[model samples]
Target chain A: MLGAMEVVSPTAPPRGARGLHRFANPGRFLRLAGRALPWVSAIGLVLVALGLVWGLFFAPADWQQGDAVRIMYVHVPAAWLASAGYMALACASAVALVWRHPLADLAAVEIAPVGAGFTAICLVTGSLWGKPMWGAFWVWDARLTSVLVLFFLYLGHIALTRAFDSPERGYRAGAILALVGVVNLPIIKFSVDWWNTLHQPASITLTGAPTMYVGMLWPLLFTALGASFIFAALVLARLSAAVMERRIRALLAARAEGT
Target chain B: MTHLAYIVPAYVSALVIPAWLAGEAWLRLRRARARLLALEGGRRR
Candidate 1:
């Protein structure tokens, strides 16, 4: 019996492999995002509509809060994601620092501004909502104070990350600062419990039943989902652009050196 | 709670702020994409 012998030389990395990193690469990220943007835009519009309609008309008004409580649909979620997003960015910064994932730092960079914007929205809206209920536009209450610190931390992350002329240096230092700042997130959560404050404590949590009824909860849920999608779409778009800009700058630098 | 003032502001903030943010993000994305496209065209020529 003649045994069939086959010799195989090394095969190239898979079709998307060399570009596996390329998919992570900005150019490819943009190509993929270009396809995704329209769908995200369409779905975002629908979700916002459903959330608003359900929140405003269909959802029952709270017995205590009446229609004033409908604001929670937006307020709670914005505040929730504001803190959640910082943690996410910090995690991304950590990954970028540790593994130096090609686009990880850029991802962190592009996202801070968006996250900062959300945090600002959260703070201002929280204040507005608080004024009617608490009788003041602002307070030094623990949770509010802690959240303000979180906002400052975000601003710091933005400033520090862009401080250095060398992008790598800026990213590494910012990553370190971001990780250090993660401690504030937990502190913000516990601040209400730890201190007697004007800010309302958590209405929803894991160990106990939620104070909000399903009618109210549903709108809040939809808004939270809508906020998440908005974040994803924005982050994708910004990251794709950042990557493209870097490529353009590199090309120009190369051309200059050649000349 | 006096409902009208709170309700109006709540709805307004909810609608206006996110709309503003969406518009801002869209504008940034559009500008960046346009610049990149212009660069691509220049390179091709």
Candidate 2:
């Protein structure tokens, strides 16, 4: 079965392995990320602006929810990014633990706080949107509860990563926590399907057509793309900072020894 | 416009949080780069 699978697979190295080898060096990553920063940031900012404007002013309001429906434009994208960011963090943690990649460790560390922020935004916006619709600001519904747990996971990862004086100790602990937290991702994704909940079922499905109309869906898609790009740019910027920090520490250590 | 209360805050929070996070990262990067340059210059002297 394995041989058959390999035969059917492309001749190229697995994309994941290829990516790991390609940017394993911090210096190489910094050079590439630095070159890409300006373009990525500019495009991200432009798309976000366009998406918000179009979503707020042009997208048709829902017949049911009226102006309140506008919240979906922001809320849905925030929720999407919160989950996506955590996935990135978990992947980075896995790489750090498995390959002992310094860049991966830093990537995981830097992503925690940003992912936490996104999760917070998602929770807050969800509450705001929920209030007008559900007649309450908070619910103990499965979906809501699982997402709350996700926010806490991000917080826990951040705290663990910074808790130890030895950075390596912190990295190992944080990576373990992140890997364990992977259980929550699927729970968050399938909560509505698995349990009774006040939260609505997903309108966008991979196997089925989106329930949203084109007008609203278009702006949502734009905002989702824009948010993703912004997330990428932020992660790259943080990664570069981390690389510089490591270099500075090494330089200081050498100077002290020499003196 | 009553719903504006909810609508405005949602959008504002979404935009502000990411913006603030990105801004913080950028500032840290700038400071780190400047410090590194200073260290390198001092070494050259």
Q: Quick one: best lDDT, which candidate?
A: 2
lDDT of each: 0.74, 0.84
Worst 10 residues of 2 chain A by lDDT: A1-10
TM-score winner: 2
The digit string of per-residue lDDT tens for model 2 on A1-259 reads: 0000000111233346565666766666776788777777778778878888998999888888888888888888889989999999999999999888768999999998888888888998889988998899999999999999999999999999899999999999999999999999999999999999999999999999999999999988888888888888888888888888888898899989999
- Which parts of model 1 have CA positions greater than 4 angstroms off? A1-23
Candidate 1's residue-wise lDDT over A75-114, tens digit each?
7877887888888898889778776777889888877877
| Chain B TM-score against the true chain B, candidate 1 | 0.82
TM-score to native of every candidate shown: 0.86, 0.92
Q: Hey, what RMSD does candidate 2 come out at?
A: 8.2
Candidate 2 residue runs with Cα over 4 Å from true position: A1-19
